[model samples]
Target: MAKTVNIEDAVSYFDTEVLHSGAWDEADDALRQKALNNAERILYRTYGKTYDIDDSSKWMPEEAVYEQALWMLRQDDAVQKTELGQVGVSVSGISVQMAGKPQYIAPEARRIIAEDGGSSPRSKWTVI
Candidate 1:
């Protein structure tokens, strides 16, 4: 699922960020690839309406997608949530309702996308 950003590019992008936790660095090739694909999918779902996903000229920011992948790796529950696509998960009587909408988005990714004018309206508007 090679989208706009590749693993090598993500690695180089994170290298310059002082706040990077090195989790992406520790992840194996398979995990990294999965994370990148998942991140891209999430972004496309979240902002696809606002941005031209198929148009390279208007491709979403690569940094935003990279930040999303890194953020997903940092979360202990991210993998389970994304993999299962579950609204809530209970383990050993501990129940956790997964965050919704904007909450699922990484902060840096959100900021980058917002700055790039990728903010999407919750509802569509049509002029008659």
Candidate 2:
């Protein structure tokens, strides 16, 4: 199966060098590919396979590809950070303001997917 997005594309989209090293590292490449696969799966599950048709006449939009890649990188980063045990620890005497929440699929990505004309109708009525 053709990957909707690749590690290089993801690195470019994120404007970071972290993922670039994954291209040469075996373990890192696996993890990066897994993230990309998960992102593509989410898009297919949410919007249907037709949304990513790969025919010569019609191809997936560049914006959609970028959005999906961004979401994929976000998920990968969240997983790595969580695995490294970087989560905040709160104390009773000290107050701390939490930073931005981690998201699997960003709102902009969701909006793009929802607007792709692949979403099912909210209701179906039957009359006898």
Best by TM-score: 1
Alpha-carbon local distance difference test for all models: 0.80, 0.53
Off by over 4 Å in 1: 78-102, 124-128
* lDDT for residue 27 in candidate 1, whole number 0-100: 93
User: TM-scores across all candidates?
Assistant: 0.74, 0.45
Backbone collisions counted per model: 0, 0
Clash pairs (backbone) in predicted model 1: none
Q: Which ten residues in a row have the lowest lDDT in candidate 2?
A: 17-26
Compare the candidates by lDDT and give the number of the best one.
Answer: 1
Worst 10 residues of 1 by lDDT: 77-86
Listed per candidate, the RMSD to the true structure in angstroms reads 3.8, 7.3
lDDT (0-100) at residue 50 of candidate 1?
Answer: 78
